[model samples]
Structure formats: structure tokens, C-alpha cells
Target chain A: MATSSLLLLLADGRFPAGAHAHSGGLEAAVAAGRVTDLVTLEAFLAGRLATAGLVGAAFAAAAHRAVTSAGSAVRGSTLALLDAELDARTAAPALRTVSRRQGRALLRAGRAIWPEASFDDLPSTPGGAHQPLVLGLLCAAAGLSRAETAAVAAHGTVTGAASAAVRLLGLDPYQVQALLVGLASRCDGTAAEAARAADEPPERLPAAAAPLADIHAEAHATWEVRLFAS
Target chain B: MRAYARLVARADGRGGTVLAELRGETPLLLRQTPGSGRAVTVYVVGGAAGPLAGDDLRLEIDVGPGAAVRVHTVAASVALPGRPDVVSRMAVRAVVHDGGALHWLPEQLVAAAGCAHLAESRVELAAGARLTWRDEVICGRYGEAPGGAVVHTRVDYDGRPLLRQSLAVGPGAPGWAGPAVLGGAPATGSLLVVDPSIPHETAAVEGTLARLPLAGGPATLWTATAADAHTLRDHLDVEVEPLLTKVE
Candidate 1:
């Protein structure tokens, strides 16, 4: 499927979509001396996956499920609900803005290349939809398999953390990659968990624990010398 | 610095609602000893409980799941003396069930001249449960220019925190030092809530916050949602207005 290749492309950290600019609050963690080394980074990433990542996975899966309902008039309503729901769930103003920013970035790129009717009608309202949901639908439209969609998400989260840490803490690329390899199983396990529970209701979907990340994100939003975009 | 304290109340959970109802219900008996003391403690030996006083007070809240409790204080906290490292501390422990609402709002604290106060509150939420908490701190006890007081609050929900808000008046803080950020404003307070349904992708939610009418005062909201926690921070800079009117 096209998604397999697309997944490979998106998984690369070199993608010039500006995704490298955000540490997703990890910058604040580093600034506050909360995430100083690789072990702390691992803990932070794990927490995010359970909390924020879980939410992203659910929305992505939901969006992917709805991608095929093109003629179904409920598409608009479903999308609207997903957008609003995600918006409400994201309490940090900075985080919400970042989500929409990344979503727009993905939408811009996906629309220019894919040019599919599905991508054409993507919402434009401020804080419309998260990038993950957008990318999930885009991947689905590109004929990606379920495994590929899950892999893209897992890769993005890990890479986003690693790249942000590299810029924030200036770590050795080899060390970070080793850390990523070590955490690869956790990401895979999380992704597999998401895939298996895809049938569960959205409200009942599991959320991994990660409150410190939220705290840091709020603190980061008010920082004076912020390095990372998020 | 001695924080004046007074509270005599029915420690009974009698009031159905503190905001809407509680008309005919016996007013929570609250009496206190005033002196602006630091180690002020009012044991819940009597009726309803009230908040600790003083501009420099430390409030610690810890709640275990399924604990039904509510707390409030009588007179508005006063910062009579602001120097000599005067402070107050209030630590809360609560573990509310799936259907408990702890409406904790003691009177706001007034920061007198050069008041550096730190207030921290923490709450942990369980699945299918709700926690409604609203509290405000107004700085500038003497109506100085740019309003006064530097208030800092850190509230957490579960292990995943919901709120971490810090406010500084004219100086000593980051935003007030420059022309941007707060725009050299004064007076700020916030109302924050955290519910289930944490966002997966992003952690900041300003959609519901931006819609708030901050009146004509200097105020801003800070919020974030990740995992099981949600946090909203609101601040107000009071001018020549009554301290009680700006809050509540």
C-alpha cells in the first residue's frame, strides 16, 4: 500500500515539515531541570505516550475509520465532533495552538501532493484538528495499512522527543538513537495496544499517565527565552 | 509575621451547595483568633472549616480517592505586615469519589507592601469523577501602580498535573520586565477546571479560556491538558477598585 512508503517518509526525522522545531513541552522540562538526561527523557516520553500520545492515537484511529465515509453526510458532523472534542481535551492554550499549527502544516503538504477530495475539505477554523488526526486520514487516503499508520504515529512521537532533546540538551545522535532503539518496544507495545483496542468506544479509550508534561507545558508557554517552538 | 485567623463552624457537610443553594441551612459556624500569625491552625473540632489567612500562606492539598470533604474560611485574608519573610501554609488531603464536588474558596489574600507569597494546591481525580475548584489571589494590597503582590500557585491532578500558575506584579517577574507578554498590566486572577478526556496530540486548550470576559482589568488564563489532568490559571491586576468586587 502507499501508506507503507508514506510511513517510511514521515518516519524520517529529516522531513522538512517543521516538526523538528517543537519539543512538545520537553524544552520546559529541560529548562526546569526536570528532563536532564536520557533516562529522564525516556520516562517523559513514556508518560506522554500514555497521556497525550494515547489521545492522539485514539483520534487518529477514529479519523482513519471515518476516512472511508466520504459520501456519508455524517462525515462533517463526525469531523466536527472530533475537532471540538480534541480541542476541549487539550487545556493548555499553547498545546492547542501547536496542535493546530502542526495540523495545518501537514494539511498544506498533504493537499499539495495528494490533492484528494478528502484532504480538500479539511476544516480551517482556528484550533480545527490535531495534526495526528490529519496525518492519520491522509495516510489512510494514501492506501496505507493499519500497521503503517500505527508505525508513523509511534515514529513521530519518538523522533519528536529525540530531536527536540538533541536541540534542547545537545545529546549525541548515536546515544539518542540507542535510547530510541531501547524504547522501540514500548512504542510498539503502545501502538499494538492502540490497534487492538481500536474497536473500543472513544470515551472508554485508555489514557496513559503524564501530568508532569502538562505542568511543564503550561510553564513553558510563559517562558521568556523559549528555544523550541512548543 | 503572624497570620490572623478565625473560624467557628459546624464541621458538618450540611450545605447542599455553597454557590447556588444553602439559603436556610445553618450558616457554617466560623470564628477565628486574629493577629496575622504565621503558624495559624484551626482544628476542625467545631463546625464547618475555613481557610488559613495571611498574604504569605502555604496551602498544601492532598486528597485520597473517595474522601468526601469541603473547606472554607471566614474573613478575607489580610497581609498586614509584608516583610520579615512572613508566610502561611494550608495543606489539603482529599480523595473524592466519582460524584463529589469540593467547592473550596476561602476569601482572597491581599498582598501588602512587597508581599512575596507562595500558595500551592494539588488534587487527584479518579475515572468517572469530577473536581470543581475555584480560588483567586489578588495582589497589591495598597493600590500601588501596576497593582502589587507576586502570587504563585501550583495545582496537580493525579500524578498528571492540571495547573501551574505564577503571577508577578510590576517587577521581579519575567513578563512585567518587558513591554510584551503582559504589556505592563496589573491585577490578574483565573478560574480553572480539569475534566476527563485528555487530548492525545496537544496539551494546551485556549478555546474555552479565550471566551472568558476578563472585565476591564488586567487578567490572563494559562491552561494545559495531558493524560488525566487539566489546568486553567486566571490572574487579575486590581486598580483603584474594591478588592472584594474584582474577585468572587
Candidate 2:
């Protein structure tokens, strides 16, 4: 498959990566009334993009670099280091579980689709490998560039929450798409930044965080009934 | 101006801890406050005014095996504005040996308007070490707008990464106060506890507060935002006070 077409496929929301089940913390924000309409939703997505989006994209790009640049002998250890560093960046246990759950799902998909890829290099943690690390490996296997991997990661960070906003708030689909379109440049810029920073060591990668989102995620996990898993 | 301070606590073998070495410079004075029991308390008093822009400060804390030390500041350290293009910085490095404990509970750091301050802390914990680290930031004083301030913290447990985060607010940080970040609250603080004895469970959110367990180890992080510093402390204390008592 053409690399560009493959990028589009992996980034698609319809992909069976289990991303469709999580709201990226939008459900909690909506439940708290902190995100009531399109304006607040835009702010939420922008904030998420700047903090969580940036960090996740950076780690993904770094992981891509690890698998592609390192020899097979050291690839597993490098990937494990990246996973541990990303775990450090993610403070919320619920968010961690969600990321690993999604990672497990994505790994299953990657193993079936690209059976010959180096999927076995992923660290076998208690839950699973982090979603970003799995994404980086899969993107690398698909012949995608590091920048493209970061873009895919950054794109999912906002799009998942944006899609959830549509269902949770019942907002206009057109308006939501427009909001995403407005954020496209930012997503690209963040991806580029993340890709550039990927050259650094794992500990030096972006660690930007959204504290309120972490709080919201923990609360959302406890909800008896919710529209999304996180 | 530039200054560096160092403090070392060692187990006295008398069911208590004592300061093995205490040194301070002009703007970073160290004072031992009277306290009883196995833990030693130290107050960080400012000998001179301002960690103003253009000032550089460094602090080193080392806790010997089985030693317990609690460090607190006498008052909030204000990041005052100085010459343009110059930034003030405070870097703290700490190490806790096996079975040692350190409670770093400092006062709020006020980032005054037009000031550029960067505070960074790196903590290393050996096996069986316990830590209670607290940090609070007040964006601005009175009616002024906040300046640029970044609080970066990295904690390592048993030589592995546990928590690493950098929170940048005001000026250069565009969307810091947005709903997903601080939600426009000027007062933000977090308490990090690395105690293996605590049960592993998630805590509920109380208002703008939430306590989360770190994934890599037996650690919990409590974060909160409030309209003001006083309320921020109250919110943090609701969850942190109990944990501190357990440490004692």
C-alpha cells in the first residue's frame, strides 16, 4: 500500500484500535458541565492538543525512531525504556489502563495485519504496551515516517475526544468537523514539533500535562453510567 | 546573584535523625526549627530579598539511610521582575537512601507580574524510601496578570522513572488556563506521595481536586486548582494532611 494511503488508514477513526470506546476525558468534562457547547469544546480540545496531545505525539515519534534506528539486539530495551518514560508522564492510573487496553487492542490488530512486523519487541507489561509505543511500531512497520507517526498520534488525541463530544453533547456534526478542521494546522505543527524532539533521549521527550484532564479521567472512571470509557 | 544550599540528614542511631551538614547562602538560608521525635525539621529562610530575575539558586538535600527529614520554607518566595530577557531559576536536587524519608512541604511560589522564573526539582529514591513532595504556585499577586513560570518535577523510584511533568503557565504558554489544563484557576498545586504501605486504589475528585496513583510504582499524586492560594491549600490539605500524618 502507498505510505500516504496507509497513513490515512491507520489514522481513520473506524480502525479497530478500540479508540472508539474512549472519549479522551471529554465525557467527564461534559458531566461536570465544564464543556457545555461548541466554544468550550474547542477550548477543551485545544488544551488537550497542547498538553496530552504534544506529549503523546512526541513519545510516539520517539518510539518510531527507536524501532527504525536501533538494531534488533537493542530494540526491545529501547522500546521498554520509552514505555516506562511514557508511563512516568502519565500520572493517572485510569488513563494508563486505558492506554494499555487500547495498546493491547492495537497490538492484536497489528499482529494480524502485519504478521511479519517487529510487534514482538513491545514490552509485555501487566496491562500491555502503551498505545503510543504500539502505534509507533505499527507505523514503522507500515513504512510510515516518524513525522507521519506523530501526526497520526496527535490527530487521534483530538479527534477521539471531538467525536465523543458529538455523541455526548449531541452537537452538530458539521460544526464539530469544522472545529477539527480549524485545529488541523495546530495538529500538524504539534506533530512536526514532536518529530523534531524525537531525536532526543527518551527522558528528554515532552512531558507536558493537563492536570484537570487527569482529574477528570479519574472521576470518569468511577461513573456508574457513562457514554464513554474515558 | 547566585547561591547554593546543601542539607544532609543522617540517622543518629538513637531512634531519631539529625542534620549531618547544613549550609546556606545569602538568599537560601537554612534554619533548624525545634521539633521532637525521630524526624528533624528544617526551615528554609531567605537571608536576602528576592529570587528576582537574573538570580540563580540551587539546593541539594540528601537523606541518609533510615533518616527522616522535613523541610519547609518560612514564607513564600516571590519571583520578582528584573532586567528584560533575564530569567530567575531555582533548581533542587534530592536523594533518599534506603529506608529514608523526606517531606518537602514548602510555601507557595508566587510568580509576580513580569517575572520569568523556572523552578525544577529532581528526586531520587532508593529501595524502601518514602517521600511526600508538595508544590503550589500562585500565578500573580493582587490584580496583576501572571508572568511566565514553569514548574518541572521528575521523581525516580529505585533508579527508575516514576513521575515526570513540566507545567508551563502564563506568557509563553498559550492555553495553560484552559478547561483541560488549569481551567483559569490562578492557584494550582500538587502533592506527590511515594509510600509503598498505602493501598492501591483511586481516590474520588473533590471539587477541582483529584488523587491518582502512578502506574510504575506505589505512588499517589494529588492535584488541585482554586480561585486563590488559601483555598488551594485547603483543597490540597483535605487529601494531603492525612497522608502526612501517616508519614509521621
Interface DockQ of each model: 0.04, 0.72
Q: After superposition, which runs of candidate 1 have C-alpha atoms over 4 Å from their true positions?
A: A1-3, A69-71, A206-209, B1-248
Question: Which portions of model 2 miss their true places by more than 4 Å?
Answer: B243-246
Chain A only: list TM-scores of all candidates. Answer: 0.90, 0.98
The sequence of per-residue lDDT tens digits that candidate 1 reaches over residues B164-215 is 3334443333223121122212233444433343222333323222222111
Each model's TM-score?
Answer: 0.53, 0.96
Question: What is candidate 1's CA lDDT for residue A225?
Answer: 82
Best by lDDT: 2
- Candidate 2 C-alpha lDDT tens digits along A94-212: 88888899999999999999999998899989899999999999999999999999999999999999999999999999999999999999899999999999999988888987789
User: Any residue pairs clashing in model 2, and if so which?
Assistant: none
Q: TM-score: which candidate is best?
A: 2
